[model samples]
Target: MPVVTVASLKGIYPPIATPFADDGTLDDNKMISNIKRWSSATRLSGIVCQGSNGEYVLLSTDERVHQVKIVREHMPAQWQLIVGTEAGSTAATIDMTKRVAAVGADAALVLTPSCYKSRMSDEAIISHYTSIADASPIPVILYNMPANTGVDLSVAAICHLARHKNIIGLKDSSGNVVKMATVRKKTDKNEFSLLAGSAGFLLPALSIGAVGGVCALANIAPQLCCDIQEAFDTGDFHTAMAHQHRAVEINTAVTSQFGVPGLKYAMDMLGLHGGPCRAPLVRLTDDEKRKLDAILRDSQVQHTERIHDR
Candidate 1:
């Protein structure tokens, strides 16, 4: 059996963005500071490390493992730590999973292996996840980030993977609630968790039996994201829709609209440590930043409480 069942794995988790200094180096101290503030967000369930938002592709193997160790040490114990140990090869992923589990991660978030996109068949994906789940010391969460990987895990693939006791859940970022519902219908809820990959569809995802979200918007608006889930659970659709409406634009701005650069900029504006992105990804221009600022102001996410230790 998995360490924790999907039933217990529901809530808003931020796919933490890896903080890099101007020199393109990991700033562990800065990241630790950010995690401390996130600890104060209302109803925040856990922290997700090294998903797309974490810039997992840009870091070295050593850096990925090292950051997981750093986050687990600093974040609150109550928060579950789900580390993304995704690698193109199954052997590499399995090796990384064990390393993270040794450090204190609650679960491993494994993305689809898309380097060989053409050959990533349903059978291939099923084999990859099953093999990793069998070998991993901790339970595994299948990550279906089609935007980044260009390979969406089919419902058939998900249903097959869900049967593995160690393969606990999925984070579907395709934003297709219909597809999400189909997966929910085919799989046993007790055995599988369907998490909204982004906050854009978190409510709709939940409406169709999703547990929660691993949202990029949660990185900027933790309380806002958490409120959506909290409101919906309590039968307050009006407030939930209010949060969801705000989430739609903010999520689009950070995720599909501007990608990581815009997300980091928004963090910097709101007193968070969303500094530079690693090379191959550039920062936003002055005009783009102005537009983002306007959007934020319009949505009333103008400022945060701004936490700091004396």
Candidate 2:
């Protein structure tokens, strides 16, 4: 395992989807195999386990911890391991945070508690994160995923949490880059960091000071995601824009258009293990799978061209 440090977090990370056997059992062998492949691929700062893409809400606490354990054991010793540990209640969140830290997580990505959405005011939001950050053994990264959680972290609340020493950064999945830029302007850059939650806007986010991203698209195209960051960092905006535009359709397919099952299918197409999602989250239909196949084939053609250009 790598030594956990906030400074080492400035690059791309794939919020990997969990792999389940056909009968719906956890596939440990597949999980280990995927992490090893991802670590050796191209340029990833780390891996995020049990994120929304990982189906964390559907998993048992023990299973979630097991996911982190497998990742820690197989991932490169130089790669950081970030684990998602959000729960419905504050006490549950704090308890899970400690459990993952005991295993090997460099940081915990805590989503806003939205079970009581009406009551999750700015004050309540601040109090929730404050309690967790105060108790967590590792640093905390606030996760603002409005699409899934319904509770979005206000800039005021995020800026307030930035004052806490234990809270290190945020993964804003809202796709509102303007708000993200506003948060960047308001918060202390050294004490706090910002991460794009999706690859759709990753290039734009980095342009406005986001450190990197935790893209679901990276599961199938890790090197593609790295190319976008590398192009931007080296001041090649024209190439970066081209890469971002070409990625949008495929990124949309695996994200809002099809969700996790679509992303898993994409992974399987690339010779990785993405067997099936758990119950309640079904697999794609035969027709939908074909559509995804067509999308991939087309994307690959464009991606190959970019590789040559670079």
Candidate 3:
């Protein structure tokens, strides 16, 4: 198969939240409906399945594969579907990535090796990713979410990996704007792409030359996310900054403060189905919901007064 490039994966692609059934299972129908809805709402280059916000670690391997199949079957053909193949071990990650590639996913977003944080050096990360990128059928995007991984791929390490023919881009979720800028300055402008992992920092990252984003904010507000990118693309700086601020507020509520359940609740409020999150990932408290409502309203996400109707 021909390799897909980082530039090919550019734009505001949502690492979409996986919707669930009331029984707390992967809701295939709801997911299908949501994917179709989001695809229609924005100019997303693709959708990323089983990403961190998707609670991928909570899913079984079979279920992950199944979800990818469902998204591909229902999503528009023009939209590329990227799969998160991050695992605790190289063997498992590679096995899962190959299986995902076999299922026709456009690319695999591989997280940095993180189980034994003390042992994960730059060489270790490079070797782990290089091995996978070399062996996998599809191209690889380095997923750098240090907040979760406890390990970060530095600018030098990323620039080295970016030079590889198969390691196309890195999703920097570190929230370190300076590191983002450094990476942008160090990497070859034409060959490698840098994507902001959080919508909260999309404009700042973009202002420094990020090509796109794999934003969590896009899960609940796809059109708004696209609008931010569109505004920047059209040189509408004022609109972009305003949208970015809104994105930061929403992200704080759903991610930094409210967690997965809050994101699901926000989704439910916004006309999308964000059913109960799976076990071990409990529902948001009523008090928390009340707080989320205030935040959403403040962000204008709850302007319609239908927080639960949808």
Candidate 4:
């Protein structure tokens, strides 16, 4: 795989949700449809398969690679496909990174090995990233999702990783603006792309110096997410703030508050195929669905009908 330029990492890229059949099998057709719809509907930087939103943790290694391959085959040529290939061990992470790269992912989003969270010292974290970046065939983007992985890559550790030629960027989901600012100040803007991991704080992240975002909200509202960045780029802070404000409730609803199932349900309501979440991850309850409907309405998201219609 070729190295992904920092330019390719800019703008809004949705960590797309994985569609599964009622029987718990990957629904290739639904996945393809969702990708096609997203590509045509908005100007996204690209699609991220097998990321946190895609339920990467729940997938087997082969399934992860296969999902990326399928997405790559169907996605627009201009769009860069980034695949999450994190594993418990450096060797395993490297191996999976190679496999995904072979299947056509433009870059790899490697999460910290958090099963041994207590032992992941700053030195251990730096060593882990350096080793993977050194060996990964594709450019590596560090993933910091402390909520899920229980491992937060500190600003110092991130800056250290940014110096590596192969470690190109970071997806900071910590929602810590001060930390993001510190990392931005330390790294070279030309070499290390800083991406907000969630839409909740994308506007603030960009205000500080983040180049773009890998937002879950982009899955249901790509245009809105992109509009926020577009507005900021054009010196339209007023418009950007409005969009950012609207995104907050929905972003929280679909992400930190509701999780993937909520996002899938939102997609379904909006006329996209957001089928069942894989087992062990249940569908939104009727009560939760009602609340999600209200959030979507308040956020002005397009759903099956008006909230009043319900």
Candidate 5:
């Protein structure tokens, strides 16, 4: 049985970066420290351990499970814990989902299987999510990351899956507000939660009824991200727009432009344990680091300590 049941998925949740040591092994100490720091720094709704920002595709099955266990053990009970359990096959996805559920994750964020993109039709996509959700011990949140997965879950298919008893919500990273609004209109507002997968257009999505965001920007600037949602929730659109504009620049830098390496570097700059990305995802160049530093400074992301010796 799943240990946590996420009744409401409204608020900011950071798709946390996986910290690796210089030797390329998981740095448990650093990861725990990062979790501790994030918990204290902001009031996030939850923490996503193996989402895209976490470099989920790079980790082995066992490593993914271990990451969730570590996060579950340390995270505050008030915060929901969601783990990315996406796999290439439905059977594999279900297995991973169950594994994470056993370790205490409240829900599984399963990405669309795009290994055979040509065959991932509407019927195929619906079946994939339906089967996984049917078997998952915990509720499943559909992950639509067309940038990485290549296959986008159409609004029609999403509306269909929204009816599933076990499938609860979506994390749409496509940045298509039109499609998001359409899906929002077609689904049951009470039963389905729509989460923007990027902070780039979080306020717009929220304006169109998105519950919150699961953003890479939140990894370094969690309070800022949360503030956007908080301000909007309280009808302060002016304040939310101000935060949203700043978030777009920073979000683009860490996500679409520089990817995981840039995000880890940004985390390091903010005095968290960002360490290194796994193999193949190299460290940022000096020029890239300088650019990222300027962006963070400009965005006013708080840092308890300086990136360099002060």
Candidate 6:
């Protein structure tokens, strides 16, 4: 009954951060608050939960399903909700995907299986995705974040899967501009799309022909991300470049230099409720905080003034 069409899944969608309580538990209160904030903040085509930035690797299967349900229950009706359904094993991933789809997630994002990285040749990886895609109740978005997953979904593998009627698009977090370009150029452009996985690569990906992005950086600066895409669409390259640079600097700090704590701090500073990250992941040190603050200030993304309010 749910629509699995490609048109509905294309655009800037942030795999949003899961805000936790000070005690490091899943803060439903803060999570719901972020959902409300994002729905009104930017031109987000949709919302993605439990992806790498959301700490999907750390959560239990039950926790992932619950988060998906809560996000779906609270998110705006017009926005498509995509859940990160990747698991350590194919059977487990497929099982989790079914539960999430039933809870109203419009799509399931499955990253390449990584535990057996050496053994996973292109053939094995294809078997994994094809089997899950064949059984998933909802549409599938292949997530290619090599930094975290180690296993890269090469352009050829992506092109091969694009022919499947239910595999919609790819979120390439590999940070390799050429890989994104390759997927964009070689895939069935009509049936599939390339979503820049990292905000740092959004402009480069777009210049080479990507449809949109699913950025961790969007967790902090949503409007700028939207504006970059808008600028390109409307023939405003200068503004797009300006926004693109700002996004790159901010993403570098929050995602690469500072990681989760820096992101949570920036989110809190920007009026979004980015509470503590879960256990095992500590907050930023004082020196790190000072540097992160400086980065945000330089990029003009840390001020109380909302880019949207302007």
Predicted candidate 6 versus true structure: per-residue lDDT over 97-190, tens digit per residue: 9999988888889988999899888899889999999999788989887887688887778889998887998888888898777777787777
On lDDT, who's better, 2 or 6?
2
For 1-310, candidate 4 gives per-residue lDDT tens digits of 3347876679999999999888887899999998888877787888888898888778888888889999999998888888899878999998999998998999999888999999999999999889899998889999999998899998889988899998889999999989999998989999999999999999999999998999999988888899899999999999999999989999999998889999999999887788788768999999999999999887786742233223
Off by over 4 Å in 3: 1-3, 302-310
lDDT of 5 by residue, 24-138 (tens): 8788899999988887767788888899889888999989989899999988888899889998899999999999889888999999999999999999999999999999889
> Over the stretch 1-310, how does candidate 2's per-residue lDDT look in tens digits?
6655456668899999999977777899999888877766668888988889999999999998888888888888888889999978999999999999899998999989988898999999999999999999998999999998788889899999988999989999999999999999998788899999999999999999998999998888888888899999999999999989878889999999999999998888786788788889899999999999898888883355335334
What lDDT would each prediction earn against the true structure?
Answer: 0.89, 0.88, 0.83, 0.89, 0.88, 0.83
Clashing residue pairs for model 4: none
Candidate 3 per-residue C-alpha lDDT over 95-209 given as tens digits, one digit per residue, 9 for 90 to 100: 9999888876888999888889999988998899888988888888999988888998877789889899888888889989899899888888678888899888888888998
Residue 93 of candidate 4: its Cα lDDT?
A: 93
> What's the TM-score of every candidate structure?
0.96, 0.96, 0.94, 0.96, 0.95, 0.96
Predicted model with the maximum lDDT: 1
Better by lDDT, candidate 6 or 5: 5
Model 2 CA deviation exceeding 4 Å by range: 3-5, 301-310
Candidate 4 segments exceeding 4 Å error: 1-3, 303-310
- TM-score: model 4 vs. ground truth: 0.96
Once superposed on the true structure, which residue ranges of model 6 sit more than 4 Å away at CA? 1-4, 304-310
Residue 70, candidate 4: how far off, in angstroms?
A: 0.5
Residue 260's lDDT within candidate 1 is 95
